[model samples]
Target: MKNMKKLIIYISFSLMAVVLFSGCKKSDFSENYYNPEKAVTADVPSLYAGLFKNETILPRYWNLYTFQVPVLGTYTQIAGYTNGSGVYEQPNNYTGDRWNDFYKNVMARYREIEKHYNALTSADDKEGYKLFLETAQVFVYDQATQIVDMWGDIPFSTAGGLNAEGKIILPGYDNGESLYNTALTELKRISDYLATVTPNNFYLSQLKSTDYVNSGDLLKWRKYTNSVLLRLAMRISYKDEAKAKSIVQGLLANPTQYPLAEDVLDKITIQPNSPTSSLAPADQKEIWNGFDVIPYPGAKMVNEIMVPTNDPRLPVYFTTNKNGVYNGVANTLTEAQVAEGATNFIFSRWDSTTFTYNHLLPGILVTPAEVNLLKAEAFERWGGGSAKDAYEKGIRLSIAFWYGINNISDRVEDKVEPPTEAAIMAYLAKPLVAYGTDNLNKIATQKWINFTIMQAQIAWSEIRRTKLPVLSFPNDPTSVAAPNPPTRLLYPSAERTLNTANYNAVKDKDNTTTKLFWDVR
Candidate 1:
């Protein structure tokens, strides 16, 4: 009993000393310490690095692969492969760590960075500080909007608070509509702030080393900001046409103020230094060797779509099978059929030389193709310029992005040539591929194809919003949890146990069938 008392006293004294020392050398605490995993204060450079670190921005390729390819790809019919293990056989069974990753790892650190940025006074380099703050704000809007997009009615206003005193253990949910509106407002604020600064300014030069996304190129960051704003505005266009149109028009009216992704060079992507540095790839084997999420071109995508249209992207997007043909596997193959080798159904995987072999390849966040396509939709709905012009431009840009001038080499075995202008014109002139008077379907379909493997999540979103390029699972109705493709992912089960009351308020509505406010199909 005496020994136990002495031990307790020693621990108490140690903790007291730690507290006293921490308080006395608060400057040391502020400067030396940097841990994103915990809710501790970190320097701006460290925070910036944390934000772009593979696990933060792109995240573990497997987690994103699970969410993008297995789940969204299956739903959108971008990828198809048979798995009898029932891992991704049903919507209910489809799971992703994105919810936890976004909230805890990504958003939590973002909040900390914001808090640190806000704490800076005018005594600091005000211009440089503001630039940093604006950049952080862009991330805040991006991350928050993504959260709202994925799971409706998320805890936004009161989500990531320092729980040192345990005040905000259970943050309440904010309605998706309000959160989206808030995000738009925030983006506008960020854009306006970015406009006040120039890329060549000394303020931006300070951030060049730390800004992993754009290398402190304020202009590119601004363009990315405007592009995100355009994306968000379009996301709500179906539900809130007037507001969406107004925002879209305002941005389009002033290209100088709101620079969009006009060219492939302007596309938002992170070009990693090495495979270990980013989630690109160490070798082709790292991509093809993994069977858990091995992806093949969907049957409908290849046969009903690309083959018929003679899409030039076919060679760039996929590799030929053992039979030297670009075949595709159906998602609805039965367990018995899978066991029987599924009729030797070999399908195309992602072009290893173009993608997997290149370790320095950029991990795309948003593409110019996507922005131009969005522009096409906006113009189609509310005429600013010729919709056909935008549509053709979008298609051409997508082709150029993939095949023309990105400098990525083709597979030696495939001998695929870069798509030429004549070929692009010829492909676009096809009755099926050509832009009609009301070519929303054509535009959406092309966008879907462009997004394959590059931005599959956004492709899923486009499909959910427009229901274009109709996807069907011909066999095994039992594999699906609903008649239609799932609208939203079920909230992570951890929320129920961690934050019971708030989780209960939203849990009943949190199912695969629940459609987001923007998903008004």
Candidate 2:
């Protein structure tokens, strides 16, 4: 009897344990930890794209502030690079942060736009979203080509895709020239398509409503597309002057053809503040001097031109401090400026941030000033348009834009401190003789200064091309200095590890100062 009783109890306990174990197993199995589909969404396209547009505040931080404009932000650093100053240290190597992010997020958006457009059989839906998609594509090409230009070959055809039978497609680098040609073709195709298509309310409801340009107006879209064509032609000017000239002639011939951005307002200004925008980080301030961050304009080209011409833009561009002192750093200042310079210079930390927001990035897109400058540059090179006329026009537009005539900047001087159009025009018309190579360099140099924030890349590119705005490196650490202005960015290290085949293919020609395929000289 005792043995049977014990056996019964043992059986009961065994059954209970098994039941508990099964329940626990079911609970554990219910949790979905390995979410592969979600992870795939996180995959980025290219580090290059991220530099221009991305969710990370870091993109703006790096490109807009650190890499893009930072070169102009601090004088000492440039001096260090130029003359090999002992105190300077270079930033981390260029990586494909922008590229990766673009693939991850932007590509997805493009796919969605494509899907919607393809689904629409009618002209209305087709034309509407098509323009937006095409523009996005242009931006993508601009960004991608820029990336490949810096890094050499990159995964092009196979980028942002699932391989055959759902295999992962890690592509190899395409040729730089091929990529450039492709970009040009893509821009042209889109421009052509836009010519016939007229987007109506279809664009309004297609995507994020606010992001649509011109309310899907195909005419304006066509203009923008042609404007891009002009930009591309200019980009390859160094390598293919004939092509560049032809494209310029085509663009110039059409007056109402493609409306260039009339002023700084035509450029898109991102408002990263209200309800979380993506413009630029509001917290960050442009560092000038030691307090917030050091302000720099160490490009020798700019310094020489401004000092010699007695350009008024200098005071407007840079501030000494709260005290309104105008001398550059005593050590870096020229002998004459140093003699007359203010030692007790004071700049506003507030101004650093304010100046960029208030004065610098008003419209935030290609401006008429840029078009005029480009014309001036092309005329100077090709000898058709009046170089002098283009030069004066560039200066006048730039000065006018800076003074808020274009609604770009608003300077308050207790009463009326902003520059008047007449004052700016008079300044540009100042009867001063430009002599020697130094004087000619002044034209490009002034254009360079006027291009702050909006077109640093163009300025940098021109400096590389003309070498006119004679610039020097910061007199700091020169370990990894480019002998001169670097024409392109080096490929990010990520390429080597993940996409070794592609990265290694073009590694040979990835020099910082190496010209693009079209850069014949």
Candidate 3:
């Protein structure tokens, strides 16, 4: 077993070297080959570059179309494409390489970054070294938590690193509960580390430039860290209400140390390298043109909810069809029915003129609207501020964000005008929109709408957590999978073959029907 594991690791490293070094110039190859030690140690910039690649979120063509768009989008009821041949018509048929993507690609890079940072000598700038480590920790928490959310038990504690160092070749799985606890501890450590740095330091300036997400703005990173902390806390609220409330109250109490994203400008976004970068999801000429992930607003999101509530940002969210009306197809449609291309059922695609389709639009990591909605829920459950204020703020921020994405053209025939303030106010005045003591449903539903195409994974996570704006199951009686939506993704086949012992231990528990640790529902 050990010999086989060593062989696998050797092959994996050789393949990785080819992938990493194939595109390098002659000069680049010489520099790396002659100065091997320097090459390993001087990799902080490359580490940051690897982290900012945006592949984990955007992914390749197969993962995007098959897994992310049709599977997750349909499950969350954000968007629905043609369910041709019932491949994505049910949860059981759904599968993804999310496990391998995180473990082999994302987490492996993070571990390498950590190893390089740790090897730094005492002569190295201590503050600079600390900044890199702390920043990496924050990202590790973000990525790892998402993995745990998707799959209940994961190889967290002993997953990444080169096998020669005695790191587990077949690491055992850790349950979600223990992983969440460790994540909270790590988040607190990062928060504490950030608290030590004073304003106008040289180390601080260097740290800022290394950050691709927030551009070294420590305040923004601090807020982002707190926001993630809040999200994790909320995730385990059902099982560990006391711990959740304590973290929430502590963060709320110390706004100076831990600020929240109060406005859309403060929201965390990853800027694209250029107009034709993969980071831009809407850049049709570049990446998006290759895939069918172009989202149509879901019917439940449009006709049943947004239309009934007279949601102010409808125009900004969806384009108008040839008839100048917003319409969405049902997810339950048969493959034959979808292929027929019925005109009345055919819905509008995303607007090309808006930032949604702009090649340069920054990839949103987390939004103020989402944080505000989370705040509203936290406040309702455990007092920190007025739930009503947070709820209203969340709605207004979401509307304002979409409005900021495009210019207001008064061409009434175009069916794409920014809603007037009066229109927004009137929409909010509706009994359903107005906040009440029992308004968790309202908050969750509005958050779902705000997520749309921007944060589909998060929308799915929230749906699993709250089950708000209850979506209907696919009505196709011929569907092969379960009647209800899947609560989690199945473990990837690699785990079954490569790490059979650990995989078998949890295989029975790993399925679409199984709820994650935090998903009490």
Candidate 4:
């Protein structure tokens, strides 16, 4: 209890500390954002490093325990939950945490970088810092995309611009589709600019030294930028198929111009490192949650799906039970049933080395599997290329991606070896695992299985869109909360308290049951 309190306190202070430079709230904009009083000025490299260090992409304590496990993870069945009261409720503080992290930790540092780029006088002068400016924009845009997907409309056009504007100003809520369009437009421009723009030796050396995410590789940034565009393009597909189809087809049509992270090795991940050292993915544990309770593999995900199909990622995703076999908790389990399973050690828990305790787990942004899966969907739907080829390649890459992650992190517990080519081929040939029968279900199911709890947010969003690997939830008749999972999260209560007028604009769409514009199925 004491340690839990300390963890909460540490997280509380950490959240407060980061926001000293953000204006997610109108009042915070005064002490937060850029106060000339605080002397927050720093070079582009320093500010870029600061932005890169945030653990939004990592499987860390706050994001996992506070947000994913309780909300998105349960909603998508990536993490196990029981039939209980308040099963699908989105807590105000938990949703607010993500909002705060983006505006303060992410956008605040980004705004500072923009401020530096904006200060430059000449076009040639701007050229020196252009790489930093544009690359950082890709990251911020990606995070913003996730935020908009979670909430309908957000303060985008003017969220953290107090540094740029140099005054206290309340930002307005921008339309979600409009925000998507803005990011898509700028992402393409940035990718095009990088394709031709060459940085001189001096600035190149500076970027190489200071750039935490891509190391001085403009090609990686270009791939990452286009990949983010692909994600957003696909996300809006059902609601706005015309725009989605054009972007998806165009990206796949020109591989050289719009290169994607199409191999397992090309995952955009940040490794763990110290503050004084280069930026890395911090391999920290989620302290507040019980290891025994939360990460248990879902009943259908393990027993009904992976076990039947012989998934290579099975061991990486979960450990065998005491009976020396894999099993997941049944969704309909009562408190007694859950207790019985736990007492008997019958349920497969998440693999410690690859997930829970692995110190080498890097923060993931984009992956080859994700890009290829998107390609598979695009080709399968629009028919510019071979869908089967893309689909098979995506499955192969997903298996290899987990192996790559495990191999990179030194095994503390027993290591899970990568499967052979023969095994992979056989798995793919299986009647249940094979492509073609219910192709959309196959695609969506594979994507969801590969995502696991590691990419909970994306897994949830994708599942909501595709409604694949269909699973059921038990009703909590005694509970006051909704019987089923929510379509979206409720906005944080703080938004109404601090940013009321702006919050009111979005309040009409604030109910958790209200679907986003793209959720049309």
Q: Pick the candidate with the highest lDDT.
A: 4
Pick out the ten consecutive residues of candidate 4 with the lowest summed lDDT: 6-15
The candidate with the higher lDDT, 1 or 2, is 1
Residue-level lDDT tens digits of model 3 in 1-521: 01222122221221133223244554554343222233453465456545655445643344455566667777787775555444444333235344555664456666666777777776445546667677767877887888788778888676653478743455778888899999998897788767776644665666565567878887787888888898889888877899999998898888888887767687777766665454554335433442355356567788777778888877777776677777666666665765564544467666554433455545566788888999999999888799888889999888877666544322223435567889988988887788874498889998998887657778888888877868777543445564456787777666776678888888999766888877876
Error of 1 at 474 (Å): 4.5
The C-alpha TM-scores of every prediction are: 0.85, 0.72, 0.85, 0.90
Assess the local accuracy of residue 53 in candidate 2 as a C-alpha lDDT between 0 and 100. Answer: 38
- Lowest-lDDT window of 10 residues in candidate 1? 6-15
Per-residue error (Å), model 1, residue 214: 1.1
* Clash total of candidate 1: 0
Query: Model 1, 266-297: lDDT tens per residue?
Result: 87877665556534554444434432375566
Candidate 1: lDDT of 350? Answer: 69
Q: Each prediction's Cα lDDT score?
A: 0.68, 0.48, 0.68, 0.75
lDDT by residue for model 2 (1-521), tens: 01222122211110122222233342332121111122222111111122233432122434444444444233212211123242223243423444454454345345434544566687764555555566667656755655554445666655644546854456666777788778877877887676665455545444333342333345555555566666668778878888888877766666565455434444332333331333333443322222223343443423344445556555555544556443334234443443233233432122333254342233234455666767766667776767677677667667656544223332344111456666565566554424124445666666567766445555555555556555544333344564334556666665666567656777787666666665554
Q: Output the worst ten-in-a-row residue range by lDDT, candidate 3.
A: 6-15
Give the CA lDDT, 0 to 100, for residue 445 in model 3. 91
The per-residue C-alpha lDDT of model 2 at residue 489 equals 62
Candidate 2, residue 174: the lDDT equals 70
Candidate 3: residue pairs that collide: 208-216
